[model samples]
Target: MPVATPVFDLSHIYKLSPETEDLRVYEKGQIIIEEDNGKLFPPSMTPDMGIGTCLLNERPREWRCNRANVNGAVGAVVIAIQFYRHHNYIANELHELNPCWDDERLYYTARDINIAVFTQIYFYELLPILLGKENMIKHGIISDSDGFRDMYDEDVLPQMTDEYHYALRWFHVIQEADIKMYDNDGYYLNTIPMVNVSLRTGFLPHDENLEKMTQGSFRQYGGGFDHIIDNDVSNKTVSHRLNKIRIKYSCINLT
Candidate 1:
């Protein structure tokens, strides 16, 4: 039942898989983002690229990235796009601050800053909120002090374990079926099924959905941590996939 552990394996999520390196990066430090009538979107995945599964209709709108569209939902996709934009934003700011800095320096520095920002948010913001700040601090998952702490070990290999992978799936219990939308004025607009947006990045740009969803992300309340699991989440193909993973991990000889 202990959710926090000292083991760290970023290779599964942090490191960009080899195949996606070319597709993700453009010139300089920015990730590739598509523009449609002045609006930015994730780069489109090529048809039958065979990286990850996507619906036939979604093939044209699918996002291309390190992990492709594997387990990609609207919320996850939105986060990715935000980071993509953040990277470009940082790169531009760095270029402005240091006019002499070349593309390589700009890219690497911006990338590092962008990654650090993500880590800060993940450890100091998200995890603290979810797992409790005091708990995170006690477990050594985060530090109370703002000062830098060096804990890196060259001997430790970066690899994820089956237990950690399986434990993360517990989050599905809090997955909301409805993705609520709101306007900048704090007015509720409407909601679309979270499942409907899966693998369907095309839907984001249509009718200012992206902007609304971005607003809704913070405004809308996530599913309560109660007995109720969203029907869509419980009955959908995603559930089936999770079940498969459960069975696979269950069968593993922990001994």
Candidate 2:
């Protein structure tokens, strides 16, 4: 059975990140939950800059939003995990906060903390491979000919037979880690709702001229209004405190 694409009326309240192209797959209006066509979709996220920590434990809550997977391409899957909510435009809150340059506009808004918690794990896994002597060859992080394929092949993708390779370019790892930290510490503080959007479809149109839709695996983010902190000297010192959190909770969860 072909699952029809869901739609939201798209009000002026919703806020998109890139705002231009297919960078975002969302709809605004009423709350809608659709079956994911029964696919085993893995939720992934790449956060850049925040508390510099991962695996945030927060209260349970619900988020509502629309999602889709456009015509697929190689690595077309965007691992954009998020949380969302919908509401009417806010003419008052707009007047209240008085607004700022970096502020996001929306009366009732959806909130998201990309899967920063997960990406940290991936980065940690690469640490040993990156610092290992034999792993570091002539060019750079060889990453097996398939860009960490040897690490993921056996357990993750069973259908893949061809062995390919690519290095995790130095830029991606650094930038990705930075993004993860930002979300972890509430760098972008207009905390909204949370949902897990997964694009498990392949990177290309099927050989049969078909494309698979994305399965959104929603996860509740925070349930409090506390993530938003008052502007203060300490509040602006998230980066300097990263090491402190690292030292404090570094081993808290190891056991």
The prediction achieving the highest lDDT against the true structure is 1
Candidate 1, 38-128: lDDT as tens digits: 7765565554664343331243453443233323556666776677677788888887888888777887788677767777777787878
Off by over 4 Å in 2: 1-17, 21-36, 39-113, 131-255
Using all chains and alpha carbons, the TM-scores for the candidates as numbered come to 0.77, 0.21
Q: What are the Cα lDDT values of the candidates?
A: 0.62, 0.24
Candidate 2: worst-modelled 10 consecutive residues by lDDT: 191-200
| Residues 1-255 of candidate 2: C-alpha lDDT, one tens digit per residue | 111211111211122233512322233322222323332222212233221112222212211122332212112233321222112123223434554412233222322111222333333354544466355543353343434332334353222122211122222222211111122323432221111111112211222111212111111121222332222211222222123422211121132
